[model samples]
Target: MSGSPLSALSWRKSSLSGPRDVCCVEIAFTGAATAVRDSKNPDSDALFFDERVWNRFLLAAKTGEFGPN
Candidate 1:
């Protein structure tokens, strides 16, 4: 993922973000992986996750596994 060109991917930010918002994460979906990068630093390396791991992480997030206890 790091070697490939991220500019080719269709990165998208959350719709909830306003025009003035600067702090947010952008995501791009690929055939084999999902890409995540900071909207404020688009040139930085993106985090890539395969389908299974990404889905698991999403489930955990939805279940508040990352929330404070």
Candidate 2:
């Protein structure tokens, strides 16, 4: 969150993206925090979070803390 907004940041798509063009969240690891944005719109808005918070988020996602599909 320390850097400028998504309008100013450089965004890129993932190389491992799926054949169906699976919608993924683009990320910029700025060392102190992680910035995420919609893959479809590289120049759009993004959500930024502290590295610790981001790690916790990934853990919860992996553990299905958001409830079953």
Candidate 3:
């Protein structure tokens, strides 16, 4: 699926995000792709990942592959 424009997609931060929205990242899941951008700098470019890679990253995150959950 083609992704909607970045400005048009709904961006959301994690519930675990730091207070005052600082040092946080926001994400938008666009049908076939996932987008990531700094909450402090939404206007900056975002990194895009395909569904497969995104899923793998999520799995690794849940499994503590990167570090303590």
Give the number of the best model, judged by lDDT: 1
In the range 1-69, model 2's lDDT, one tens digit per residue, is 345465565665678787665677788777677899887666566788997899999999889999995
Q: After superposition, how far is residue 35 of candidate 1 from its true place, in Å?
A: 0.5
- In candidate 1, how many Å is residue 68 off? 5.8
Best-fitting candidate, measured by TM-score?
3
Assess every candidate by TM-score.
Answer: 0.80, 0.66, 0.84
State the TM-score for model 1.
0.80
lDDT of each structure?
Answer: 0.88, 0.76, 0.87
- Name model 3 segments beyond 4 Å from true: 1-4
Listed per candidate, the RMSD to the true structure in angstroms reads 3.4, 4.5, 4.3
lDDT of 3: 0.87
Candidate 1's C-alpha lDDT?
0.88
What digit string (tens of lDDT, one per residue) describes model 3 on residues 1-69?
134367888999999987888789999988889999998888778899999999999999989999974
CA error at residue 18 for candidate 1, angstroms: 4.7
